[model samples]
Target: MSRRRVGLTGNEAVALAWKQIRPHVVAAYPITPATQIVERFSEYVAQGEVDTEFVAAESEHSALSACVGAAAAGARVLTATASQGLALMHEVLYIASGLRLPIVMNVANRALSAPINIHGDHSDTMGSRDAGWVQIYARSVQDAYDRTLLAVWVAERARLPVMVCLDGFTLTHSLEPLEVYPDEAVQTFLGEAPTDGYTLLGGEPITVGPLALPDSYMEFRRALAAAMERVPQVLEEGVRAFRAHFGQDLPSLVDARGTEDAEVALVVLGSYADAVEQAALRARVRGQRAGFVRVVTFRPFPTTPLREALGGVREVVVLERADTLSGLGGPLGVEVRAALYDLEVRPRFTDVIFGLGGRELRDEELDNLLRAGPPGGVVYLGVEGSRVLELA
Candidate 1:
């Protein structure tokens, strides 16, 4: 249970935690921000520090394909990617989850390109929102490291793949202090590598990824959907077991701060959480009752806490780094609104899409927003065409 402070970037933290867990296979390719994770892990493989099968895949698609294959063969598998790299792996992402492979992937969240710029954003992960993976975001380097370990525990238990995501350059490259668990404690937390007779490595022969004809295709899809419904429960059990071993509890999937008695709440996610939380505190200094809600587990959507976080607030300001152009608001905003759609006593919602493609948010942006009170609909931050686009 001894913990010591160590300095590490998000990518290094993921690589370090993953190395400790020692997955059976790692399928990797070099992608910005995310590359450091696989590259650092590769050093361990070369140095004989880890007994992992390192697959130097040709492309992101090949990387995930290799993970699917390894995991299908009952290997604890892992991989890392971001941005278009994730886009390239899009097809196989579904297959990994469809076949019920418990592969743990680290996505250094980045902006998907048409303009060909590479930096941090949630566009990559947001695009795959329905890819049937349990997506969880980390707010800092320590969270990135801890969450990476937790993802493995959760994925193996649920037999569902998990994506531990971090902001591309912001967190991925920024070094910070974090406490790492001792190796023995980590093993105790994870328990034995799970093998519940649903793999190719088992004695009984089994086939995976068979093409389902029309009669069974719908049923297969339903099974996957139903499996996702079990994620919240799996997450609950996983966190409980983790807390019992570590003596420190992981916060629930969604975290609420200053919300117990507040008229305004800010809903946000990812690496910018600290800033948003500070914005909430600053609001309090000005005699405004402000609070903030952060999404930790993005998939299965954490509906319960999200609804409770905004329960009695009179207005909500949702700050998202990624925007959904086709929708009424940003991705997180749309989801937050959907979570409380049927509830009668819900706060008014405002969606603000900011900091896309590593865009620099103005120094006073958060302070100004807190001072101005919650606006209505989609507000694009720091753009030249500056105008509030009303929700459609």
Candidate 2:
């Protein structure tokens, strides 16, 4: 299929892809960054472009709860939210995954509120990391569109919920030209949903919501963990299929740039990696063997792949947009340290927590930060009066 370039915001790209997927049900509440996704989907339903049920949910929690009900009935379901809306739906988020409902969601990654910021950050999704959902991050509008289609396929195949995240405001509201594949391409790539005996029927009664007893609870939890464990293989297959049909190869876990024989590596997730990649390139041009790794998949954590990528490095810096306040560790930093725990020759590592609440991360700043590194300890970029620690 021929792909045509269309200028679209990240949210619009996601909405367009969801339309092609033709979900049976969509329940969403309007929220910053994520509002446009449902708005566009609702328009498609209204225009008869999609023959689907569109439910305008009263609240974010209700929206996710409605999607869970629809998905439990074996309907392909979708929803979107940002920041506190995502937090509000936190309870059902875990339930959706625990029940193995396969709901695909677009999370316009935004900062969680205290004083309240409607802009982009990883805090919202980071807050829900324990919700048992597969999380995928996109760096561009095109990736945002492509990943949404893949998320549905991945979720249903793994029988797990998937969140395709784009940095709110930064990517969500940023306009970019997207190469949208035809509907036939998407259908060909994703194939059809499984016709299992899971759907809710008019007269046929089947028990979906059941009380779990202590006798079977542990077994059920183990099965869910097993399903998540199988996700990497399913995701790789889906990416291959998607590339065959759409001519775009999606990275399932991480994208490595100039890592061969590198002594230092900078690691980041989501859109910020784009900046880091450019910085790495500039560093490389100056005869420094610096490299960058962009993590695309966050949940199930991608430990093995990351450890393999960082094994040869002498120094590493982890750039995180989300913080684990209680632990005094950035989310990505903690995960990176955990991945390197058993390695015999671990690199000097630094945790750089920056770009929170939609603050911009400059390429020059990243280059300078990486250059002046023992690469140990925490540094907060863009924060006033922040001290940079040089660990011995």
Candidate 3:
């Protein structure tokens, strides 16, 4: 297996990975932050670098619809979008997953509109969290590239749509050095596109996406839930294969650091976790038992791994970019708290909300926050006006 080190933005890295995968179809609508991914992949299509049908759909909905159709027809399929574009695909997001189509999508995570901000945040993907897709977040250009490829494998094996999310401009536009594996190595690792599932092109009479009556609808939903439960096993299998073939150690679904014996831990997702980790490291050098965990896989929510990581910690701070708007902290805070609720010696947890609409989490600010320890409830950091919102 050969490898080359190269400089690329997160979007370019993802596009290059797709080129190597050479899926049968890519249907997408260009959107800010995420547009460059499809733009670069389209160039690959035009230059004949890969034999793929590129469909420039009129809207994000149409783009994902095309991908759903192609995937249902037994073609390997993918697409890219962000913010409003991803919101537009919300309805079809469930359709793809309900039909169990192995469609993979890349989302340059961006803030949703109301005041029309186009910056990076987890709001877009977290908004569509219940749409039944395998959600994976990346912290760097290399993570974006490797995880996009990993998402494809997980999607196919789990028979569910996978969303590979990277921070909008933060990761998508920032340049970084990454290792590129040989095409044959990647191809050999992924093997062939799955063909055992139901397909429209199978040349047999079959009912696809039929309306299930009230009696059977519950069963269908239960089956989808069961499929999600089985994904951790399938995802772990792919990670092992990828490690063996590419000699690259990808982060586990729950990427924990310094938490094995640390007394304080911060739980976060996407690139923001990198900042928290750096601060935690400094705190450790200063004799503070501080640690942080980056959640790589958000969907199916890695409850078991998280429990193991935070089980013995004395205090936990969950910092999230998007608010749950429930006056109960953020989406991740709610989930993490629930995940650790049953622990025998539960940590004193606090929810720190920050980085909404691409707000930067500065190192000094994070350093200050880490030194303060857990506040024992919900606190708003870096936001003006109201600083702390105490939850009853």
Model 2 ranges off by over 4 Å: 202-204, 389-392
Model 2 scores a TM of 0.97
Tens-digit lDDT string for candidate 2 (1-392): 78888899999999899899988899999999899999988999999999989999899999999999999888889999999999999999989999998999999999988869988889999998878999999989988998999998899999999999999988899999999999888887777777487567535787775788999888988998899889999999989988888889888988887777888898999988778888888888877889889999999789988989998899888898999995556988988999998999998888888888888877666766766753478778767665542210
lDDT of 1 by residue, 161-207 (tens): 99999998899999899888888888788877888767888888988
Estimate candidate 3's RMSD in Å.
Answer: 2.2
Candidate 2: 10-residue stretch with minimal lDDT: 383-392
Candidate number that wins on TM-score, 1 or 3 = 3
- The 10-residue segment of model 3 with minimum total lDDT is 383-392
Worst 10 residues of 1 by lDDT: 383-392
lDDT for model 2, on a 0 to 1 scale?
0.88
Best by the TM-score measure: 3
For each candidate, give its TM-score against the true structure: 0.96, 0.97, 0.97
The candidate with the higher lDDT, 1 or 3, is 3
